[model samples]
Target: MLGLWIAVIALVGPFAAKLADVQHDKVTDYLPASADSTQVAKIEEKLPGGETTEMVLVYHRDGGLSAVDWETAAGQVAEITRQHELIGGAPKGIPSKDGTTLMYPVASNEPGANEEQRDKLVNDVREVAQGEGGLSVDVGGTGALATDSGAVYDSLGGPLLYTTVAVVAVLLILIYRSPVLWLVPLVVAGIADYMSMGVAYGLNQAFGTTVSGQSSGVMTILVFGAGTDYALLLVSRYREELRRIERPYEAMVAALRGCGPAVLASSGTVAAGLLCLLAADLNSSRGMGPLGTIGVLCALIAMLTLLPAILVLVGRRVFWPLVPAFGSTPKQRRSLFSAMGSSAGRRPLTVLASGAVLLGALALGSLNLPGPLKQEDSFVNKPEAVVAMETLAKAYPGRGSQPIDVITPQGRADETLAAVLGTPGVDSAEKGRTGDGWTEISVFAKSAPQSAGETATIKSLRDELKGSYVGGDSAQQIDLEVTNARDTKIVVPLVLVSVMLILIGLLRSLVAPLLLVVAVVAVWGASLGIGGLVFEPLVGLKGTDPGLGLLSFVFLVALGVDYGIFLMHRMREESLAGAEPATAALTALRTTGGVIASAGLVLAATFAVLTNMGLVQLVQLGFVIAVGVLLDTFLVRTYLVTSASVALGRKVWWPGVLSREPGPAEPAGSSGPAEPPRQPESLRAP
Candidate 1:
């Protein structure tokens, strides 16, 4: 098995890094599939130039434009026209009424639909349109913004993966305390990550799955986070089994038998939950569904197969300084969880109530959260394009720097132009390139771009020119927000239903599954609330991502239930072996709590690595998931759920065989509550 895995790794390793090259990060790649903007983008590709890259070169002075500034601008414009294809004959400068700002609209098909080429063109324009002293020049438009956004996504591939690995490595070293033991899982996780990337690339080739930077980055995270989680559980169990079993192979088999179902069920639940994103109308969210599932499944496969084979080959000595010797009992020490369990056992109701209050308080922070983040404000660090937009917004008030593109039938060009000019809030309308059956009309709004007035103008244009399609950065943003809202209404319910059903199937008890679901939902709210409180004050994020609530909810609920499965599965095991309810719950905690905590720390840290990324959206997603996992790990799973179980006793498993069976009698030798019974050797089934 080890030899076979080694061969497989050799074959697939080379293709893994290639996944970064094929990633698509264009704005249109993330737009809603059925949105009018998406249709316009598609049709624009088939036009005369494949797809025009539009930009506006803004030249400004604090007081006013001098003759020298005007001369410089005109010379640069001439050079630009000489070097690049301009839509019209000579570039016409539209001077602001204040005479302080002049913007020249530049269009070219040279960049086509390639983001890299588009960025090159934007950069080239910036190189030529330079200013010194009082005059300032900036290149700002949909094309420039797309280039900047693409740069952020491009950074995600190498830096994001390396940072995640480094973070996970540090956490694992601290948790394991053994250099050799930590390397095994980390290596296996790396392999898993590579395999996921290769598979994701294949999916893109086969099914045309959209591979955005967000989706791909998320895939890498799950591989490390979820794969490490599986590793921790398996390794902990394997060590325990090694002390009891003689042969390493047999010990591994016993370990897999003990915790394999829990790991499988946990990964299954996460994959299923992510797959629910397929129902989303937003292209990015929908594409993330399958890519995320692929990541989880790949991690599961690597951990279950390659990890076990490698560990078995290395034998017990691989543990090195902390090696477990056969026939020897592990040193017993009082665990923090033992104390936590005892406290919960003593006051289940009080503990539960206190936890509820804390979560509720945290949830209130959501009220303080800012509004939805605008495209211009989406980056953690300001890009040149954003700076340009800001400069233009301040300099040219009540005027649009970017034109709203209207694609109409060529035969109705005159009527469409008239209707566009007559649209409320439109500052100017002009005929653009024509190809096939479509004629492009450029409409400039009187209001500042991305402002409410501009938004209203866009809506009015769409309403009046029903036959023509209105699309630009502003229109696409409108579509994104609307689609995300609609998607939330549809996908949230589907995710909830799917997750609840999975929990029920795994636990075989509706109440327990429902309990886990509710707890996770509360955790999601509380985590987001914490983000609301800190995002602006601590991180300086202007606003939250529109899809933040729904995405965080799905991730928190699905991944949070993972630890629940680990704990509840153990609780069920004890109960089936004739252990009383409270004793069973406490004993499960004492045995599994440490591993769950370790898994949680690893998962949390891996996601927190995303907080170091450049995009505000990624940072927010990472923070919420990290906080949510921590809450579920240390508080919800360890305290509240356990307390609820202790309080409910055997009734926790109502309608199950364990609940209906006769309770075990008290121990003959003990006066206090009897210790939870372990499964009899003869009764243990693999």
Candidate 2:
């Protein structure tokens, strides 16, 4: 198995390096294909100019602009025009009413729709449009914003990977308390990540899957986070099995047999939940589904095959100072989980009620979450484009600084321009780039971009334009908000039902699946509630990512159920072995709780790395998932689920064979004596 994996790695390693080359972060790549913004983008690409790159140069001063400042702005604009082949002739400066700011709109067809060309054009323009003294100059517009956002996304590759690996390694060292044991799984996870990348690249080639920076970054996160999780479960079980079995190879087999089903089921749930994203209208969301599945499956394969082969070859010495000698029993001492299970078993109702109420209260914080994030506020740090937009918002109050694109048939171009000019909130309208049976009309709103008034104006245009397509940076944001809402409605229910069905099939019990589903759903709500409380007041974020609700809900519900499966699967195994319901519940918690906690910490820590990312959406996603995983691990799984199981006894598995009383004859497949096995000393409550 090890030899085969090494050969496979050799075959696929080169493709992994090529994955980033195929990734795109264009605005249209993320938009819904059916949206007007998306249609406008596609149609413009077919027009004569082939989708022009647009930018705005802002020159501002706290004091009124002097004659020198005016000449400096004109000279800079002229220099930019001289340096680059702009679509229109030289740009004309539009001075602010306050006489403190001058703005120039620059458009160029040379770059067309090529991102690299556009980035180069924007950078070249920036070099000439430098600010000196009290005069502040910034390059801001859709093209510049895309470039800034793309740079941040591009940087996410190396830093994000290294940080995640470092975080997981530290957590593993702490969990194992061994010098060498942590390295094996981490290396295996890295290998799995490499394999996943190659497969992702292949998927893109074979199916034309849209690979965006956001989706690719998420794929890497899943490869490390979920991959490490499977490794922890397998390693813990192998350590336990080594104490009973004489040989390392046999012990590894025993561990795989014992824990493999639960791992498979958990990973399956996550894959299914992610696959539900395919139903979404947004291109990014749909693309994420397949790439994420590839990550999980690759992780699953490596942990199951390569990890076991390596451990078997290394033998018991791989465990170092804490090696599990043959036929040796671990020291018997009461653990934290034993005490927790005891408390839950003693007062299950009170514990369950308290947890539910706490979750309910936290969920109310979602109501306090800020509105949809604006493009200017999307970055964690203010780039030149965002700064320029901020300056424009202040200096050009009550007028739009960004152009609103309206694509219409050539025959209707005149009528559309007239209607756009007559629109109540349109500050100005002009026809541009007539070709290929389409005419592009640039409309500037009477209000600031992405503001409530501008949003209203966009909706009004869509209503009046009929055959015309209205789109731009602000229009794309509107489309994103609307599409995310639509996806949430469609995808959330699908995830819930899909995950629940998987749980039911795995557990073979209606009640148990329902309980696990409810717990995870509650975790999702509480985590988002926490984000609502912290995002604006603490993080200084102005608004939430529109996709946060849908994405977080899917991740929490899917990944959060993983710990529950570990605990409940053990519980079911114990019950099937003829242990009484209460004993089985407590024993399951006592035996599996520590490993589950360790896995949870590793997963949460890996995702928490995203909180430090530069994008607001990534920060929000990482925070919510990390918090939700921790809650599910420490609170819901440890306290509430265990308490409920103890409270309900056998009925937690209602309608399943285990729910009934064992007959006088020995329980089928019982390895121990007919009577229940004696409780272990380590599991005893102090």
Candidate 3:
């Protein structure tokens, strides 16, 4: 399949030029207002303060931009604002608050316009500023900022790119210690990623699916880590076979025969686990199910097909100076692998018990985690929207903040507000009272909605709006700015649950499938709790984009479960070999432990890079997943499984067929002894 893919690409490269336009960007990617965010609809809705397209604000003073200069700047701003027809057209004027700095508001006439609008807007600005005296302007806003974020990869991302690639490559080379063997997986994985992402884009186009910008980073981690993992499984088996088999093609066959089932099973479970992400209600969260699964599947297919074919084609040279360490004669059972098996065959209890307690304890945190799903919550630091919103809040009639639209047919806006203000738990309402004819009263409270007092006030307001006004609270818009955010929380959880059930069926597991879900939830909760504890008192813990919560949980559980499945299945395999359950678990841990650790670290670092990105949601997600992968890979995989295996011992299987009988007959021509080892240290399994 991989060969066919490479061949197809080669064959189609030239023809595609004549076929139809091949886009570098996905159709979904080009959607107006960013289809990836759930907030789009809400943001697009008409509310107070008016929605404005993002515009860059550039002003200089003094020794920079001056007041007289700013007056000219303001004049220039007004002129541009008048001439332009953009969402946030040229600033009406540069307001000089300090008399030294200029404040110009740039508007895009077309808020959701395409590249054409951006180009015209840019050119328009340049024309207007042909030669303004002592006036300097640098465009900066959503359009500019998003461009800058992407450009981060284009510029400083160079070192980051090299670092990521080189780290993975270097690690692979070190582990495999065979340059020729090392390079094979990298190339195949790269090709797989390209095909998968491209196909995913195509699928999204056909289905109207949307993906977050961070999807790219996740894809990168999946391709590198999962790709290398698959390749490691295949090549390691191939090497093991070479020692026993003389012929190159024959060795390849033997390798596949010996290890193919495990690889398939391993990759299958990982893919199945990730497929659970379809349960995510958030577009940003659930979209990864297919995106990541496809890449992993493609890599698996490559490992199965391209790797073997290439090895056969390359003959003996695949190992280079390593030569064929494997020979014609059947080789001795590996002391390490065999010893591991034997020890696991002995005492499995200790191993399983220790590991289980640790993971379960960590899993506790997930239960209390808040379900955050909206795109707006991720803003930790103050942003233009926030600052402007705060400024407006301070300036509005009810302190110039968000207005609650009370739908009561009976009362005036001012009277209703006054009534609500007088109600219990109400700190203060900035509005005087409900005004004549207006049932909805804009009320400003002393506290932010995030504060308990505010929430309590909102509840009181709702009650008043329901009882005090002619209409009920549901029908009327309360001046409360938080209703939609609360509504989002309600919706996102149902989505996550749906996605999880779908995943459970795909993974074919009951005992531990939920563990991944639990793990993800725990990590998410812990991160938020910790983040809140640290940030809440400092600047008031800003809730992250609710999408980040779902996104983190989805990815952590989906990807985190993948690691779990790999270890669990391997532990099961060892147990079946007659090692006591505890020992088998340890054996599984030891063999898979290094790979899990390495994979997690690489992925965690990749995600951490997003924290440096300075986006609220991105940083929140980075923190959550970074904590999650660490906990999952190290604590759960290494610590928990070992303990569970030990504690369960022989009965871990219960009434299962395996527990009822002696282990199956050792395969013919096998070197494992009929007798199990007494000591636990000797047991190990992958």
Candidate 4:
């Protein structure tokens, strides 16, 4: 099924992209009025003090800033100001202050300009800036960011295909140690990727869903990451089976049957978590939720259907080098899983306490970390914008302002704001336009955005201005940031509650759910603390994109919890066999610990590559998520898995609904107390 699905998808995937590409907006319509908006309207609106509005322009010159270069920079500023379409110019700079090579501000020609116009206008400015010189100049920021981003998105498809093929080839080389062994997983994963792409593209085309550059690359990465993971688990057991059974097909079937359920549940849980992102208010964010869900879902479907069929067809060659051992089943007792389990079980409290303290300390930094979604640093110091900014800043203290436009629909002009121009909090206020008798006033902030201080004040100022001027029939609108953050944080407990409830039903335990989320929460705090540590030293484009921190919190809290589920499920199985609490705890660690660790390592590393992306948001996002996953898998999960088991003891499988029936007596390991019980079908030797 995986192979066939791939075949069908590969045949049609391009057609799907082509159809969806038709909706691509070269020209944007009115302001976005609905959640379903998929065009240039996705471009953020610029308010007087609203978020993501200002552009950072970098200046370049030969051999740094000389007297002549400063003069040239001033000339460049004059050149930019000549374009009268936009209401203003990016202010000039003072290179003497703080090594700010060049800086200033520029905005759209029309206030109501949609995303398409803004993007084209900015790109045109960049082109115009570039045309003036011999210097190598590049323009960035949200305006240029999206334009550059689109090209990057188109490039990902080809690279992703290459990456998928490369990953399979590499995995086969390392694990099988022979090029011949590469063909099986390569073909299987390739098919899965192909099939998954078709579904993703089909959905996008049908729904006008937009897949950005980061998401595009991520889809490929996940397919490779997960496909390789599933293959590894299956192949390890398959090799074990081949040594015991002469019938290769039967051996393969047994391995598949054993690993099948775990794979399904793991994939399902990941997909479910990702789907929750759809609740985000941003269309760009909401659009991604479904793509991630579909990719994981496809991987799950492929593992269940197509992989089995392929294994059946391939026969003995799947384990060609190793001859089949006859008569006896491969040894199963005293496995590596039992070793780790027993060790952790012995020191459960120590391990659990240590992990809790470590994560708690990391959580403290997150509380104080500042900044919101302002893209100042994202501006790639292009020579024209930078020089232009430098000239203005040098000449005027606050000319290059990040303005907040407050529109009041009423009989009065925005004279209240006009009256507050000399007020303390404000650097300056200028009366803007009047539409439908509604007056617009612009407020210029004196301070650079820092954490929530300026953000909160700006919000307050906007509110006061609105209250002072708004009439009975006139309404006030503020466009700062509509984050799902606060609401999401509040509902997180609810989401965890919902997840806990599901676990209770699955594992038939109430206490088990709390332990899992607690372990998950521990990892979440640690991730945030670590993110602050990483950012404390980074003095680049990372600071400009505020969504980076938010993404870290989201990814770490959600995806990092997955291994907990996998670990706990195995623990419950081991405990029901009438093993003592310590014994059962050790058993789960021995088996699930090693595999979960490897999975986490791969997952963390995979996300780490996101840091290499050209985009700042993706880079920050990639690093933080990658670290969180590693911490969860290695630091938190390793300790908590055994600790929770020992702590819960008999109630690990509470309600006794999933209790095991009696089986043949088995001996305990002398190395340590074994979680004594005959193997259940789920973890049994064939």
Give Cα-based local distance difference scores for all models.
0.86, 0.90, 0.51, 0.55
Q: Clash number for model 1?
A: 0
lDDT string, candidate 4, 1-686, tens digits:
54666576668667545533432322121111231111112222333221222344455554445555556656655676675344454565634344435544554435445545555666666655541344334453334544554454455467545744664566456556554555776676666666666677777767866565555566666776666666666666666666666776787777777666666656655665556655555444455567667766766666666666676577656555643455655445776546555666777778777767878899886664444434333333323333443443443353333454445544555457654564445667665544444455556656433324344445556456643331100011112133434436543554465566556655667777677767776776777666666654553443524445444554565566567766666666565555556666666666666566666665666676666554556666767677788877766776665676787666656556433333345322222354545663233211
Best by TM-score: 2
Better TM-score candidate (3, 4): 4
Candidate 4: global Cα-lDDT?
0.55
Candidate 2 residue-pair clash tally: 0
Error of 3 at 41 (Å): 5.5
Candidate 1: TM-score? 0.95
> Residue-wise lDDT of candidate 2 within 1-686, one digit each (tens)?
99899899999989998998899988777999799999999888788657778899999999988999999999999999898888678989999999999999998877345788889999999999987889999999988998999999999988999999999999989988889999999999999999999999999999989899888888889988999988888988888888888989998888898788899999999999999999999999999999989999999999999999999999989898999898888899889999999999999999999999999999999999998999988999999999999999999998899999999999999999999998879999888888889999999999999989999999999999999999999999999999999999999999989998998999989999999999999999999999999999898999999999999988889899998998898888877766788888889899888888888888899889999899999999999999999999999999999999999988999888877766676662354457555332121111
- C-alpha positional error of residue 629 in candidate 4 after TM-score superposition, expressed in Å: 2.7
Per-candidate TM equals: 0.95, 0.97, 0.66, 0.75
Could you report the Cα RMSD, in angstroms, for every candidate shown?
Answer: 3.5, 2.4, 8.8, 6.9
Name the better of 3 and 4 by lDDT: 4
Task: In angstroms, give how far residue 436 of model 3 lies from its true place.
Answer: 32
Candidate 3's residue-wise lDDT over 258-279, tens digit each? 5565566556655665566555
